[model samples]
Target: MTTPLTSTQQAILAYALEHTDGRIEWFPASLKGGARKKVLYSLCRHALIQPSGDNWQITPAGYEAMGRPCPAQKSVPAKPHTRQNSKQAQVIAMLSMPEGTTIPQICIATGWQAHSVRGMLSGVFKKKLGLTIVSVKTDAGDRSYRIA
Candidate 1:
């Protein structure tokens, strides 16, 4: 089934389609960062956009939505999802330790504050990432986390 883009998504698609042959750069003055990501996510989910390393590009659907002609080589610039800046990856690695690390351990390993670590754990697990956390009894405290 095909999904329709939201107005914001449509705008993002339009902007991207308009510059298929060139780089599309936007800043807060043009499109706020948070709004930009929301639109990007929507476009990506419908296959209307794809990341090319660090930039975004319009997919065929995105072009059609914009009533624009598609390029012979259809492609979109997308930001790569890397584990280097991924909280989930960091948490998963810390949870793998034999000692059964604590939240503090995760925070230290990821260079995130205790609250940030806790917030990410709550938001991502069993939700966005479809992972679950398992709590293990430890001398330090109840080290809660997901193990693969």
Candidate 2:
């Protein structure tokens, strides 16, 4: 069941909906400080504005409230995918580098284990950013990635 939101939550949802692009949504810090904790929490809990890697966006309710069709929603919206933590962000940045470093190299640079490195590539980058993994079989081994 959809819980009703207070005016403040609605306001916050409206604002978030107004600004979200595919990659990012900017909230004015001035408006969302400690005083607005409940408002923020409510929007998030109800799946109205989902947390992106470093931003937030309008979920189905938010889209519906704004008189638009909620993209791909059949009923209750799917849970918001969790944002990338700092470690995940570091992995994304490194993988996204022009030189296209390997998993081993990334592990060395970031101090993460091989599993964590692979998780970044498979978990967040592939699912969240919608990127494809690329590799070339060199004489030594497979190396590199590019947005595919």
Q: After superposition, how far is residue 111 of candidate 1 from its true place, in Å?
A: 59
Per-residue lDDT over 71-144 for candidate 1, one digit per residue giving the tens place of the 0 to 100 score: 78747888657576576766777766655568877877778898887787778665776666677776655665
- Model 1 score (lDDT): 0.66
Q: Looking at candidate 1, what is the lDDT of residue 129?
A: 66
Residue 23 lDDT in candidate 2: 21
lDDT of each: 0.66, 0.66
| Pairs in steric clash, model 2 | none
Give the distance in Å from residue 21's predicted Cα in candidate 2 to where it truly belongs. Answer: 29
Q: Supply candidate 1's per-residue lDDT for 113.
A: 90
